[model samples]
Target: MLVSLFDQERSFTRGVDPMVLVSPSIDEEMRRKRVEEENRENNSVPLVEEEKCRLQTEILGVKCSLLRMERDIAVMRIERRVEMERTLKFIVQTYLLSLFD
Candidate 1:
């Protein structure tokens, strides 16, 4: 009688315990949930990729503009240097010509 009672108790406990039963349907549902999550993540990936590409494009445009500005500044610097050299040469020539006159 004690053994029968113990067996019944074990059966009841196993029936009530969630870990005791692993149904294939439960596994399929879990797999379905995981697939759904992965699908959601995959769907968002394209938006993230697009945002990354847009940011990269904007960064490249800013870099190009900066490069253009740097080139313009360099050209202006060279032009100023040449102007100064020409002015100095004219002054020296005028002074020498006056001394001769």
Candidate 2:
């Protein structure tokens, strides 16, 4: 009986009061909007949590890459030092051979 009061007419009528005509539709639209907004609010909590987890994983990946780069640099430096020592020993040995000749 209460809903009947707000029930809309299906057929178009001329010169009916616009307020009475549009009121039920407006109320229903407002109720739908409110429900959608509540759903969005409820969903934001998990969205925020997912973002936090993604950031932590990215940080861990960056740290691991940095460690790998540091290890590679150290290995290159050792190889360079060994090569320099071998070149120095070859130079000294050649000089001694020339002196004997």
Which candidate ranks first by lDDT, i.e. highest? 1
Candidate 1 stretches greater than 4 Å from native: 1-29
| Estimated TM-score for each candidate | 0.66, 0.52
Taken over the whole model, the C-alpha lDDT of each candidate is 0.88, 0.85
What residue pairs clash in candidate 2, if any at all?
none
Count clashes in each candidate, considering only residues at least 3 apart in sequence or on different chains.
0, 0
For candidate 2, the lDDT comes to 0.85
- Model 1 alpha-carbon miss at residue 34, Å: 1.5
Q: Tell me the lDDT of candidate 1.
A: 0.88
Q: Mark the 10 consecutive residues where model 2 has the least summed lDDT.
A: 3-12
lDDT tens digits by residue: candidate 1, 50-72: 99999999999999999999999
